[model samples]
Target: MLSKFVAAAALAGAVVTAPAAAFDKPQTTYKVFQFPQDRIPRIDGEFSDWDMVPESYVVGQDQMTDQDGGHHNPDKTLNIRVKVGWVKGLNRLYFLYEAKDDYWDFSLPGLHNDTFEVVVDADLTGGPLIDVQHQDIWKPEWVGQRASKTDPRVPGSLTHWYSHGVQAQNYHIMTPHKDKDWAMAWGSPTWIKNFPFANAAQSYKFTPGQSGTYRLEFYITPFDHADPEGPERSVESKLREDALIALGWIVIDYDDVKTDAKNGFWSLSTQRPMFGLASDLPLFKLMPIENAKLEARWSWKVVDMDRRLVAFHDDSVGKATGWHWDFGDGTSSTEQHPIHAFAKPGSFVTILDVTGPDGTSRRSKVWDVQLR
Candidate 1:
C-alpha cells in the first residue's frame, strides 16, 4: 500500500502542468533560520529556547499590513512577532509566534476565534489550492449561496475529496485554544495536524476576554503532494539547506464577540488572497547555520545489493581539507565521497575521519551497512 501511494504521488508530481505563479514580493526574500540538530527549539510555548535566534530573524509587526482596509492599529490594539526555522535532514518547519492584544476574544466555539493562519507552498506549484478558489468548478454566482452536499454544481472530487489542500496547505491555528484542537487543517486530509506531521503548544496567562500576551510554538511538515486520503498517499517536500519555499501568515484578529465582523486581517504577504492562492506567498529561503564549528558527519546508501556496492556522502560542516574512510573490513580510502564494493555480504561498521584547519573530527556508524 505504501509503495502504491508513493508511485501515485510520484506520478502526480511528474504531471504538474501549471507553472508557479509570480511571487508577491519578487524583489525581496525572507530567511528561514537553520537550527543545528542539537539546538532545535522545544515546543513548550516558552521563549527561552529561542534566545539563540538573532533579532534580524524576527518578522515583527512592521512587516505585516492590514489588508482589510488598514483598520488594524498595532500600537493601540494588536502587536505580533513571528520567527521561522528549519533543521537540516528534516522535512519540517518550526515557528514561534508572540502576540499582545488589547482584547483577546477567543470565546467562540468555531471560526470566530482569533487565529494565526499559515499557508505554505513548499514546491511553489502555483495556482489556487483551496476548493473555494477552483477556477472552473466554483462559480462566482454562488458567492452568497448556501452549500449543499448534493449540489450538482460542486462535485465531491473537486470540492471535498481530492483537489483542495493537496498541492499546498493552509493551517488556521486558534490562538490560545481552550476547548478546540490547536489548529484546523483547512481542507481534506485533516490528519495533517496529527502527530508525525504536526504539533503545537500555546501558553497564555489571561482569560478569553482579558488583554495579555500570548506565545505559541509549533512545527509542521510541508508536503509536495498531500493526498486527501492520508500520509500513505502523500509526498513530503524534501527540505534541504539553501532551498527556497513559499510561505506566508495572517493574524485574524476578532475584537468583539457581539458582532460577526472581524477586527483585521494582518498578513505577511502583500497579496490579499494569499491564504487560498499558493502563488501569492512570499519566498522564504532556508538559511545555513551561522558561526558553525568544523564537525564531521556522513551518511551512506546501499547502491546495489548484488554487487555489495555502497555510496558514502560527506555531510561535514565547515571547510575540510582531507577525509579518511575505514570500511571496517581491513580496508580504507581517503576520498571525500567514495563508492566501494564490499568483498562479501555482511554487516560492516563504517567510519569517516575529516581533517581541516580547525582540527580533526571523526564519525562512525556501527554495523549499519548490511549487504545480503
Candidate 2:
C-alpha cells in the first residue's frame, strides 16, 4: 500500500506538482489550545482531558478532485472524520488524534495495512524552506501505529504486520524526508533514538453505538531555533508558546481485508490530494498556555439550507466562564452551542464573546447562508 506512492513518485520525477489554482487549498492550518489541566494527559488513549479542546481544522476531498487520477476521500477510509487536538506546556507539546473506521486489519505480508501518520514542522516554519514553486512541504516528524508485526527490528521502519498482527510495532515514532531513497528514508536518526521527551501510545475500542475507533496520544519535546542532530531541523525549528507549527495527518485503510495489491490498500493524505506528495501537508498552529486571556475557536455544521438555520459549536481556549453570541440580527444568545435561524440570507456577521476569570475575548465570522 505505502510502496505504491514511493513507486509513483520515483517515476514522476517529483512527488508533488506545482500548486495549481484549480487544486483548491484545503483547510490545513488549525489552532491548538491550552489543556484544561496543568499536567499532560497520560498516554492511556482516553479523552478525559481532551473533551474541552476544539478541533482546529478539517480536510475534505474537494481539493483533490482536480488531481490527474480521481481524488480519494482522505477521511473516507477512516469514516470521513478525523478529529485532532493539541496542547502545550513549558516542557513539551502534546497531540491527540482520533479516527472513525469499522475494521482493524493489521494482517500483512505487504505494506497495505491500517496505518496512521502525522507530520509536524519540527522547525515550526509554517511551511518548508526549500520551496521551489511552494512544492516542498513539511514532512512527517512523528508517526504512530498499532497492532502490527514486531520483527526485523529497525530504528524507524515497522515490522511486517504479518509477523505480529496482534501486537504493537516497536517503532511507532518515525522521521521522514531524511533521504531520497524510499528505503533510506526509513532509517531513524540518532536524535529520534536519543530524544528523552519523544513518546507515543495507541489504543483501540469497539462500542455499541460507534464504529471501531483508534486514538493516538503523543508528545515531542519542542525544539529551539538551533539545528538539532541532522538536516531535519534548521534555524526555523522551534516549539514555543504561541508558536505556529505546520501539522498534518493521513489514515490508510484496508477495509478489514488484507492484500498486497494497491486496490485493496486505499490511502489518504492530510493535505496532499495527489497521494503522498510532499507539498501539501497542512498546518496547525500551537496556542499559548491557557490563562485568563482567550483563544477563541469554533466548529459548525449546517442544519437547514433554505431556512438558514446553522449550528455553531464553541471550542474556545482559556478559562472561559461566560459566553455572548450575536447572530447577525438584533437577536442574540448566551448559549455556548447556539442554533440560529437567520431572518434573511446573504452575508451576516456572527460574533461570540467568551469571558473568563481573567478577561474576555471575542470571535466573529461572516456566514454566507445559502439555499439548499
Candidate 3:
C-alpha cells in the first residue's frame, strides 16, 4: 500500500531533497461553501474580504529587525484588514503547506475549533514522487508534552516561540486530530526544526459556526541546526526577507458557497487549528455605505454656522466625483444632496471630506449642527 505519509528521512537520518512542485500554478481554490439552511444560516451578519495576505510572520520581535523575523520589510508583512466581501454559511478555515527549505508555523490564538488540514497531492509530469502521505496531528493532554523532532530545517523553526504549556497564557501550539498519526520533535530551543535559535511567530483563524471569517499565515527563513534545534545569530537580514517571499501565503473567506446541509456540524470538539475570529469586529463606516437602498452615487451636505439642514440645491450640484459627510449621528447620508435627521435635536460636528477625479476638493468647514 502506498504509505499514507512519506518518509522524511527514512524515519531517521536519510535526508532526501524534495522534488520540484509538479503544478507551480496554484489551484483555483475557494474556502468551504456556505449554505443558507446550515447551522448559523447565512443571515443577520456581516462578511468581507480579508484586507491582508499571508506573509512571513516573525517569531521573536525584540527589535526593529529580528534575527528570526520572516519578512524584514514592514511593507511586505501582512496588513490584514479585510477590505470587502459578503459573509454567509462559512464554517471553518483550512491550510496546506510544504516545508522544503523554510520554517513554517500556524498559530491560532483563541481557537473556537472548526479547522481542517488541507493537503494537496502534486502530480508533476516528470516527478520522482509516485507516493504521498496525509495525516492529522492531534494534541496530547500530558503536563508539558510537545513535539520533539523537527523537520524542514533548511530554514529556521518558527515554532520555537510557542510551546504547549509555557505559552498557555500568551500562545500555544494547535493540537492535531487524535486519530491522525503525525510527527513533531519537541525540546528546549531547537524542536520544531533544530536549539539556540532565533525565536519566531505565526497566526491563523478558526470559527465554531458557519457565521464567521477565516484567516491563515506561513513563514520561512535560512536554517541553522548543528546542536539539534534552536535559533541562530545571522545578521544578514535579507535572508529573512527572501524567506518571506519564498514562502507564499494567503487568507480567504467562504460564506457564499451553498451547502445543502440544514444542520451544522459546527462544534469545537475538532482539533482544527486555523479559524475565523467570529467575535464581531466593531463596524467601521462601510465604503459602499450600508442601508442606503441606493446602489448608485449618493451625496449629503450640512451648514457650518447654525449646524442646520442648509439646502445645497439638491439638484444644483453637478454630478459629484467623490465625497464624505459623517452626520455624526448613527444614520448618515450622501447623495445629490443628503439631509439626515437625528433621533433627537443636538449639536453635532459635521466633517465633510470631498475629492474629485481631477484631485480638487473644498471642505466648507466642520459645521456645528443642531437638529430637532
Best by TM-score: 1
Return whichever of 2 and 3 wins on lDDT.
Answer: 2
Query: Candidate 2, residue 314: CA error in Å?
Result: 29
TM-scores, all models, native as reference = 0.82, 0.45, 0.19
Candidate 2 lDDT, tens digit per residue, 1-372? 124453254234232222222121444345666554455566665656666554443343332222212323333444433444444324455666555665555544334445544444333223222212222332223122223354323323343211110110112232111112111111223243234445556666553223576666666443322232343542223333454443444444444343332212222332343222323444345555544357676666779877878898786767777889887778899998999887776666778899887688887887543434
* Model 1 stretches with alpha carbons more than 4 Å out: 1-21, 69-76, 133-161, 328-334, 343-347
- Residue-level lDDT of model 3, residues 119-180, one tens digit each, is 11111111111011111221121112234454322113333222221211101222221222
Per-model CA lDDT versus the true structure: 0.80, 0.45, 0.24
Q: What ranking emerges by lDDT with the best candidate at the front?
A: 1, 2, 3
The best candidate by lDDT is 1
lDDT digits (tens) for residues 1-372 of candidate 1:
013443354345332212223777877788899999998888877768788889899999888877764554433478899999999988999999999998888998988898999999886665676755455644312212223455435546334445567778999999978899999998776889998799988989999789999999999999877877789978898776766788999998888788767777889999888888877888888888887778999988888878988999898987789999999888999999999999987888889999998889999999888888
Can you list the residue pairs that collide in candidate 1?
none
Cα shift from native, residue 30, model 3 (Å): 16
Q: What is the clash count for each candidate, in the order shown?
A: 0, 1, 48
